[model samples]
Target: MPMTVGALRETAKGERRVALTPETARKLVARGLAVIFEHDAGREAGFPDATYVAAGATPADAADVAARADLLLCVQLPPADRLTALRAGTAIVGQLRPNAAHDRLEALGERGVTAFSLELLPRTTRAQAMDVLSSQAAVAGYRAMLIAAEAAPMFFPMLTTAAGTIRPAKVLVIGAGVAGLQAIATARRLGAQIEGYDVRPETREQIESLGARFLDLGVSASGSGGYARELSAEEQAAQQAALGERLRVFDVVVTTAAVPGRPAPKILTAAMLEGMKPGALIVDLAAESGGNCVATVPGQRVNVGGVTVLGPLDLAAGAPLHASEMYARNLLNFAGLLVRDGGLSPDFADDLVAATCVNRVGEKQPQLI
Candidate 1:
């Protein structure tokens, strides 16, 4: 018998992105796996039950899908109560944030459910297609730039009008990762004068390619695996001093700087907020990771003095349609590793499989953050 894969409607609050879309379901069904999803699972993301049915996927009751699934796919790990509903020895794949889900992960381990957390996947050229983090970050970045544009008191594009000549908003995006690059590109498309900054000096070309100038603070925190290393205290102090002076000229600032498994570094201090022009806008995409700005409150928009500061959470969820499509494709590529030819034959020796598997059936393992 072929392995059965299933996805449930995401129940997390403010989460609208579905794990499996009909397009991906069709691909998986063609791969010889039985695709099952709860009815209305993709409705929130614009895929109705009829679409999945047309794609050769069966719409089953949530409980039935959970009971019969040999492999379960998800966006976020289900809550503790929902985890208890899953059968033992069922393999699950998702961005199971083990770092923040100690209790829930413990439940899965106790139930002897095999769990794979994609956040632990190795960063390599071969693993790019299966990179959920990068794929979602791109969506978040693109959306954040739009959020900044919406909140800005001034226009994004320069205009020569009959009334007056209006200049474009001067925008700065900090962090040159996938999110930052996407933000720069989006900002450029919106006709903003953009500048991109990152602790990794190597991102200058990327920022420039997006039609944005690279802001250099003369501090480099380049690290392995394409992530920036934590800056030393002295280095941070120097960078902040330079940034404080340079940032005052921008009409908008978007901070996307974050270190995986760590609290976001404070890139914009309260004192720095005072220097920005009145009515200036700030979007902190790292808000969920404790924010790169002093005034950021995750999921809130507030005024720090006269400047508008927004800390929007789950921007990818805000753009659910394409985000779900990209994320579903990411999950589909990852599923390819486990389902070889037409059967579940995951090789434990494969580095991608070994690194991402959080726990094996019947055994608890030390999970990384």
Candidate 2:
């Protein structure tokens, strides 16, 4: 019998992205994998039931699909209760944040379900096609600038009229990563004069290539996996002292610095916020992991000293169509490692499979966590 894979509609609050898309589903079917999806699974992402059908997928309610499939794909970790219903040994795959969901992860092992967290995929050229974090961060970065522009009182670009000339909005983007670079590019397109900052010195070239000046704080923390290593207390204090003063000069500030599986470091302090001009905007893309700003409330917008601080959650979902498409491609490529010749292969010897597999066949791999 062909291996069956199913997708459930995401139940996470404000999550609109679907793990499967019509195009990806068609590709899976072409590989002789049985594709099943919950009814209306793709609706929120602008894909209709008819679209999935045309792409050769079966649609049914969650319960029916859950019982029959040997594997399940999801946008986020599905709720514990829904996971409990999956048949034992079914492989579950998605961007499961195991660090935060330790309890639910244990529950999956207890239920005898094999779980794979794509977030654990090793940073390798072979795994680039399955890089969900980079794909989604790119979307969030582009949207962060739009959110800042909409919330700011002044226009992004300069203007010349019968009245006196208006200067372009000055923007600062912290974290010269995929998201930060995108934010810088987007802000520039809107005619804003933008600058970027990062703890890693190597990113200066990437930032400058995007037409934004790189703000160097005279410290470097380059780390493995292309991520900045955690800064020491002395380094953090130095960075804060220098950054707080420079932050006051920008009309808009976007902070995207985040370390996976850890609380986001506080980059903007209350004193710094007090120094900003009235009506200046700060968009914290790290809101979900605590936030880059001290005052940030996840999923809420707050006003501090007349300056607006916007912390958007699930920013990728705000632009779900393309987000879902990119996410689905990543999932399809990752799943190919598990499915072979029309049935489950479950080869842990494969580096990509070994790194991503959290639990398999009722055994929890604590070392991987």
Candidate 3:
């Protein structure tokens, strides 16, 4: 019998992305794999059960897929009840933040489930196509500008009309990672005169390459492995002071700075928020990790005087269709490392696979055995 891989509807609050899209399901089925998905798994993402069936996938409830599947594809950790029902030796893959889910990790290990958390994938050329963080950051970054344009009372583009000529909205985007770059590009496309800021001086080229004027606050915290180092207290104070003075001009500020597995660095302070122009907008993409702004409440819109600050949770889920497509493609590429000729016989020593799997594969994964 062919190896069966299945996905269930995400139970995470406000999550709409599904691990399996009809397109990816068809590709997996073409590889001689059996695709199973819970009923309504992709419905929220605008795909129906009929679409999965057309792609050669079987429609099953969560309980049925739990019992019958050899592997589970997911976006978040499966629900506790679903986890309890999973067969011993089944493999699970997703952005399972192992640190925050210590008890769940131990539980999966005890049940001999091979848990693969895609977020742990190493930074390498081989892993780029399967980098969920990068793909999803693209979604979040693009959405940030859309949110800013909508929430801001002012128009994004300059206008010349019988009424006076209005200047373009000034947007300053903080951070230069995938999300930050996308935010700059999207804001520019919306006709906003935008600038991008990052703690890493090396990113000036990347930010400017996207047609955005790079904002330099005279702070650099470049770190190894393409990530920024945490700023020291003295440097943080200098950065905040420099940044607060500049916040008054920009009509829209978007903060995308984040460190994986760490609380988001406090970039926008209460003082900075208070100094921004009245009727301005601040969109914090790092809100899920406690926000880059001291004033932002994760998943809520807050009013600081007349300025609007939004900590949008699951912003990618807000654009579910394309987000799910990109997410499923990333997962499908990563799936190549695990599923072999219609069965699971992954090489445990493979760097990409070894870096992601958080639990022992037991005997089902012959390489681990």
TM-score of each: 0.97, 0.96, 0.95
**Residue 165 accuracy (lDDT) in model 2:** 90
The sequence of per-residue lDDT tens digits that candidate 3 reaches over residues 1-369 is: 889989999988889999999999999999999999999999999999999999999998889998888888999898779867788778888888877885687678788778888888887999999999999999999998999999999899999989999999999999999999999999989999999999999999999998999899999999976789888999999999999998899999999998788888888888887888899899999999999999899989999988899999888898999999999999999999998767887788898998887766342321110
lDDT of 2 by residue, 71-94 (tens): 899988988777656987788899
Question: What is the full ranking by TM-score, best candidate first?
Answer: 1, 2, 3
lDDT scores of the candidates, listed in order: 0.89, 0.89, 0.89
TM-score of 3: 0.95
Best by TM-score: 1
Q: How do the residues 268-350 of candidate 1 rate in per-residue lDDT, one tens digit apiece? A: 99889999899999999999999999999999999988999999998999989999999999889988888777766678889
lDDT score, candidate 3: 0.89
Go through the candidates in order and give the C-alpha RMSD of each one to the true structure.
1.5, 1.7, 3.2
